[model samples]
Target: MVAADGGTDRASALVTSAKFSEAAQRHNFEAGWLVRDPWRASTVSDHFRRLVANRLFVAL
Candidate 1:
């Protein structure tokens, strides 16, 4: 259940629904935080670029 009082409902839903895979859960949780975190949004561009680069290298 979500900490509806002052917490993230969507994240709660994702958890309750068991949508998070074991290896990916931490990443998913962090992603949820990023979406809700304004500070994270401001700096995520660089992180996204690096992530894309890593993925591209893997794909190659």
Candidate 2:
């Protein structure tokens, strides 16, 4: 019993997929992926770079 889902249009698919995965007795879980838009990329990258540098080399 294996189940996988990604992107939209997941619900209509779940109805048929649920049967193969033992939907009645199985546990459910929720997970999400991190995404950044082009506009935010530079800012996020700069912040991340500084954060890593600070962690690696502590300032006096």
Candidate 3:
């Protein structure tokens, strides 16, 4: 049920399963925060840092 198609053999038209690695997830979130709210990047960065330190978001 990703896109393009959603039935038997639907994955044929799709590319990825939408699953990303831990590092990729981190980078994506950081970049998204920058693009979404540059002014609040620092605050968001600190939040993510804490999450990472607490092993809540990414393991690395």
Candidate 4:
């Protein structure tokens, strides 16, 4: 079973409270490309850019 908001703690809390089991389960997290507000694109892009900027870059 896959939950859309599974990435959030609230979803996990609800699932646990419902007695849903994840034991021996293969997990996958996908950022669904279904943002309602179109303006979220710029916001998400900027956030990603900032995150990458803060990371140390190494050249091999």
Clashes (N, CA, C under 3 Å) per candidate: 0, 0, 0, 0
Off by over 4 Å in 2: 1-36, 56-60
Task: List the candidate 4 regions with Cα displacement exceeding 4 Å.
Answer: 1-33, 56-60
Between candidates 1 and 2, name the one with more favorable TM-score.
Answer: 2
Which is better, 3 or 4, measured by lDDT? 3
Give all candidates' CA lDDT scores: 0.38, 0.38, 0.42, 0.37
Model 4, position 39, has a per-residue lDDT of: 48
User: Candidate 3 on 1-60: residue-level lDDT in tens?
Assistant: 112222323222212334378876766543211122333443445566687799887843
Better of 1 and 4 by TM-score: 4
Superpose all Cα atoms of candidate 2 onto the true structure and report the RMSD in Å to 1 decimal: 13.9
Q: What's the TM-score of each model vs. the native?
A: 0.25, 0.31, 0.34, 0.35
* Candidate 3 lDDT (Cα, 0 to 1): 0.42
- Model 3 off-target regions past 4 Å? 1-39
lDDT of 3 at 1: 12
- Worst 10-residue lDDT window, candidate 2: 8-17
Worst 10 residues of 1 by lDDT: 6-15
Give the Å error, residue 31, model 2: 5.1
Model 3: colliding residue pairs: none
lDDT for position 8 in model 1: 32
* Candidate 3 RMSD computed on C-alpha atoms after optimal superposition onto the true structure: 17.1
